[model samples]
Target: MTEVTDFFRQGGGLSDTLPSFELRPGQIELVRAIEKSLSQHTHLVAEAGTGIGKTFSYLLPTLQHDKQVVISTATKHLQEQIFFKDLPLVEKALHKKVSACLLKGRGNYFCHYRYEMFLGSAFQLNKTQAKKVSRLQDWVQQTQSGDLSEIAAFVAEDYAFKKKITSTRENCLNSECPYFDDCFVQKVREKAKKSAVVVVNHSLLMADIVLKETGFAEILPETDVVVIDEAHHLPKIATQAFAEQVSSNQLLELGKDTLQVYRREAGDVEGFADCVEALIGAVDDLRDALADARPNGQVQLAKLKQFKRAYQAFQVLMQVFSEFLHALKALAERSSDLQKINERAEITAERIKSVFSPTAADDSHNDDTERQAAQSVAILEWHADYFKACRLPIHLGNRWQNVMQAYADSWLFVSATLSVGQSFDFFIDSLGLPADIATLQVNSPFNYAEQSVIHILPDLPAPNQHDFVPALVDAVLPILQKTKGRAFMLFTSYRNLYEAAELMQNSDFHLFIQGEHPKSQLIDAFMQSDNAVLLGTVSFWEGVDVAGEKLSCVIIDKIPFPSPGDPMIAEQSRYLESTGRSAFAHCYIPKAATLLKQGAGRLIRSNHDTGVLIFGDNRMLTKSYGRQLIEALPPARQVDSDALFTFIEDTL
Candidate 1:
């Protein structure tokens, strides 16, 4: 507490060093809690609202602490922000040297072996792809980090070209490769091993958890403190990491790799080539079976088994895959490269078999309870593009508790929106934290009531009603006209976004659609354009910060309830129903409330910022569940259309 106070007091640590820094009470309190938690080696759940200066608050204590730390964020942008921007400022303020490194997923870095292979196989690529590879080759020589994001000409949207030059876990060859010492991924990991603080994203953290020794083991070294920023996203990411999936693309790649390895080692053995071709054909057959069966949305594999064609496809795929594995094993005796490929192929086959096979009940071990718990929540799913079997843990608290107990000595979970109705129960239960875990909530210093207004349109139809979109467009048009399009029209779905875009197509305001440009570009264009209206879906709801008059209005289409039809949501609902609980009230509503809070938060970024938050959905006013949603938001004044108009007029 004394350390925190010294840093936060006026004319203290930061104020004397940083010219524009002003100590906020909330930030100081959070930093104190973090310091105490680290000292005691306990877990802390903190809901530090926007403007709490959460990054600096957590970072200062982390740097002051004598032990190694790992700070995981939800986005690469945030990872970079912490490493490049926040860390430097904190180090400067403290006047102490702190070593920090930023590490992204391996695919982000260029692989020399893969680059050479890609160049050798240029004849297989189209002219456009060849040109892109040529440009990448030039950049590879000049780039220091070897990170693909540095190449201005390399558009990651072109997945094929990107994959051609990047190394995947299956093909990396690891220590066997000549470039192992100079490998960009290896170099990053080496840096992370030595750095006092390592910055990574949720995906990389999850990879370390799941892959253990094989993957990110080197990158995630033992650390005294582990801080998870954007902690709300952890549960979902953890569930995904632990889940199993078998896709046609994976099988296709396996077949292609086997062929390449066989050709390099055995010079195209007749029977081996035939087996590889058969394996590829089997993959195509499974895809055709899926297409013919038309699993239009995500269907449980159990349900899909009722469709004979799909069932037959599963059987055929399993048999062919087994045969392919046997062929690879036989070839493995001849070539070490083929042996490694065979081992990988065998692992994939086993995973696919496990998805098809029924789980064996075991009563001997207590650990079986956890396994059964996960199995109970698991769903085998088939979508239009891929097939997957995953566990969507409804309550992550126990799982997270176990993870922390096993791996970390001290843990801090920080997020802008972690509480509902001023209680952390919803977030706590989701993360499986015990009630006694140290909890803190710091409301944003921004004066929301003075800086923004929550304007809910009245008498509009429900989202399911046919006229909803039209009525929404009608209701928002005048507000857009009043504000002159310095607004974000956030929708829950692409359908709504497209419908709104169509209606607003003839408007004088400069319109920016989500998919029309990259998100960063769209934000840049929006900021640059006078009176620009940006129409986007879920991604725009969070991670957007546009202060001042460049953006003054945020219009949300409806309550952002998770789609009830989603496989994960449906399974969770079923699990809740079995236990005689209302999933809608407990799960759906709280999730929507959290999202709504995020959307409304976009309006007032700073104390000086003023804007109107418009919810086109009438449900916030008409629905019984609406009150809970409103309660979770910042305490902004509710205003009618006339008041909204007057407020906008006065502010702008």
Candidate 2:
């Protein structure tokens, strides 16, 4: 058997490469824990901190194991970094003959069939698409590496002809699409079948798990082990993946897709237009109702009743849509084509059923009796929170759970931040994993106590205060003055960001807001400007990486908790509150902690990366739970508010 060290040695033979990796005792212990767990087919969550070279620690052992290993990441950036950058480095270092495949959600690739359909339309012949098609065609011919981010620069239009289609599960047509054989999805899946390791994002991994459990084909059937990186995000990702909500956007898309199908089939173009108008109104009404009902305060059983009213109206719209589709199906001579459309609608209707069902079991039964049973369970579970917990059609935690029971030989979840305050319970419970699941935590290679500074602004106004924004700006200005910009002012709300940016009123710094430009453009502006302040919300917290002098300080306005008034949050809180649990702790606090950690995580990405983490929210010092939040974070030196500017000035 080839040794694990062989892959990391200087020139590339397992034995020849083994000599270079002078694995520190801690690193070796982590590898041993992971290897032991893999050998025993136990679940493990290992916290290999920054500078620990966590990626190599896990990759080396997995490569040596020579099993079909799937490394799942939380973000596409990390996924690409692993597949394109880190994996190659490891593979080259060890000189091992292991094939690695990178799989993204299907929407990343041009759906040839969908594109062809769009081509048949008059609107698609516009200058933008023409240029895009030309560029895409040229790139396709020259490109040996089939990654979509390469073409992301060219395809500037709506990624989701259906929804924001970057790479996702919603639009994946699987075997039903006419262009299945030459599909990029299939191509990657084929590669994954042959490769020893497959790198994918968490959503895709969950999608595969969902498909696998339902007896549908999945991407990792040939895989024996799994590694989930960015494990800190697992809980929230799981919760979100498991939760269900019917948004106006989803309903609108369905209506549009239905109209498109109608226009294509029945030459009754005017009727299709009418259907679209009706759908627009119905979706508008639904949105209006939701907007009127705030998510946070005034929580009563009445809110749920109101949501039901909206849901019922939406259901009626779906029924009317079904009737129209049925009429179209009946009038159509092309049974096969019409059947596909009707079946799609049927599946869409069943989405409600899937949301509430015992999703832990395969609900894709064909037999009359089994189908009936599944339907019954779904019906009974509809109003139950347990049913609502599955974040399917978007995420696949429930589905993955089912699939793992049947096929996965072992699963390894590794990250720099997996545990919360030295506990994996937060993640495990959220992922719906058993409490007894094996887990591990590895220390960081960097000396956090000596490096990063965690500054708590105890005197700042409460986050909800009107003066909070100005005070935050005032508090952060000193730090900014010290560094001369190069900071990320992350906020929980867009309104807060706008308010803070407006108040800062500093012309010396290039102020970039989240929605001002394309994220890439905004990031570029931030990177290029000598002293830039990027004000952003949730998305900026975790995935962003700005090393060196580009980012010197991170100012988090407050702990990022989900807005209480969100329809989903309201419903969740009500459900939890009814169950005799403190919705604040179970629903709100954990979420806030997770997000706070993510926001704080932006401060120290690498060992060389140094910055001041300033939490402008006074709750960190004033609240009792604040200590718990601090304990969950990396060991950073605390700085006095008055001394913060001096420290930054010294460092910069």
Best by TM-score: 1
- What lDDT tens digits, residue by residue, belong to model 2 across residues 289-344? 44445332222212234466545654555556555555545644553555665565
Best by lDDT: 1
Q: Taking the candidates one at a time, how many backbone clashes does each contain?
A: 2, 15
TM-scores of all candidate predictions against the true structure: 0.92, 0.82
Each model's Cα RMSD: 3.4, 6.3
Error of 1 at 607 (Å): 1.2
Q: Model 2, poorest ten-residue lDDT window? A: 378-387
Worst 10 residues of 1 by lDDT: 356-365
Candidate 1, 517-570: lDDT as tens digits: 899999999999997999999899999999889888899999899987676777
Regions of model 1 farther than 4 Å from truth: 124-130, 155-157, 213-218, 285-296, 306-312, 359-397
Reference-based lDDT, residue 432, model 1: 68
In angstroms, the error of model 2 at 570 is 4.8
